[model samples]
Target: MSILIALKQQTDFTSTEQRIGHYILAHLNQLPTVLIKDLAAKTYTSHSAIIRLAQKLGFHGFRDFQRALTTEIVTQEQQAATVDANFPFSASDSVTTISQKMASLTINAIQTAQQQLDTTQLAPAADLLARANRIFIFSQGDSQLRARSFQNKLVKINRFALIAEEYADEAWNAANLTSKDCALIISYAGTTKIHQQFVAYFYEHKVPVIVLTGNPQSPLIDQATYHLLTVQDEYNFAKIGTFASQAAFEYVLDSLFAVMYAQDFHNHLQDLQQKQQLIQNGPLTTK
Candidate 1:
């Protein structure tokens, strides 16, 4: 786990420790240079409390923790300067400025998603999708669009996929899912009641489930057999659109598709060549 994530998800911290951790999280830019005594005074704790938190983080002392945090800050501070995910542009902005801001926002979102990935989980998720007899995507709203695009890519690679909720057939799809099938769920908040119920059903049936989500505290995370994450700082209902979350989702999907392709790289290339020839010469050709 990254230091930041560990801090965000700290569950076993004592009351004093939680205050210190919360302070550090809220003031990350200042934490690197904050003295232990100063932090203690600010959080109404003592220097020993700070040292204890540092030790829990596996650092020898407060200074070591600061040094590690400083290193993380140096590498992880590269966000788009003026682009906001919620409202990336305004009516006053020219067309060129709008286009450029959108591009920068996308680049920053994708880069941040990459930083949040737990690479060890990636390969296993790909393997689950590859080995499943069938793949079903469980998503709704704008996220379903990303799932559809992913479904199309899988089709190209000769791996068929189904959007489980297409035409409101979620229950039907869930009823038909077997242990041999795999579920790929995409949700930003990951708190939908129906999804929770469906995941429980999949769990009871011993089906493999993979969820790609932005929320760190999502209960779906614990239910998943394998998972991928694309955490982005975007609101659920207040955003202009699902710009940052969608970009992050696209990055993760593209990565998974690339990995699945690499698993049979030579065979996929040959298949592509054959498909190209068929498109060129077969009666279905448009050229």
Candidate 2:
């Protein structure tokens, strides 16, 4: 598990341990320079408590944990710095160079997503979708566009999925959701007011919600019944256009679709083939 995952799963930790975890999360960059004793003092805890937390996180000790964290911080900073949202190339660069950089950035994003994604979460999400009466999808902007693509995939398998792009539509769909329905929400920042409002409605209605987000510390984390994370480290200005975020979202959605499709693989495939055959053969006419 990553450092963020460790902190997210700190329910079993003691109060001191939880405090130390939160401190480390909030001040990740300073881990390289801060001493164990200083960290303990800051958290109002002892050195042993700090060491124990590190050990629990699979580090040898506080120093070892700090070293790993420093590496993570530096690597993230470097990747973020290299990203170019505007041109992704300089005036001197050729088209070939620009293409290579774009490919490299996209491939790297997918690989990082593969490594960071927790496969353990996929199975339960698949099971929920497989059993759901209908799937309600909530998202905005680029993420919503990706949700529409996933909704198309689900339609091919004869699964009912509704992608609500507007707030009123999302609220209407969510309000009508029953226990047998599921919600899949996609957001990069995970702090959108509209997303939160609909998520709250789903929570109150006892509807299972699956959220895909880039921010682990997002408020959607707690609201989601199943939360899948994606890292968009390839983008410098994330707001410009969601190249990496859209790629990661599609990758995750494809994985979920695969798992759900595998539950009744043959039947779904046959159904899809039959539908294709009907379309190819043309629509029926009145006799």
Would you give me the overall lDDT of model 2?
0.79
Give the root-mean-square deviation of each candidate in angstroms: 3.6, 4.8
TM-score of 2: 0.75
How well is each residue in 127-220 modelled by candidate 1, as lDDT tens digits?
8999999999999999999999999999888999999999899999988999999999999899989999999998989999999988878899
Clashes of 2: 0
- lDDT per residue for candidate 2 within 1-287, as digits (tens), equals 35666676684799889888888888887788998889989999999999898898779998898887777667666655665533456679789997887776676567657756876778898889888988888888888888888988888777878876655666677778888889888888888988888788778878899989888778887978888887665443534467777787889899899998998999998987887777776474223
Highest TM-score scorer: 1
lDDT of each: 0.87, 0.79
Positional deviation of 260 in candidate 1, in angstroms? 1.0
Stretches of candidate 2 off by over 4 Å are: 4-12, 15-87, 166-168, 234-239, 279-287
Clash list (residue pairs), candidate 2: none
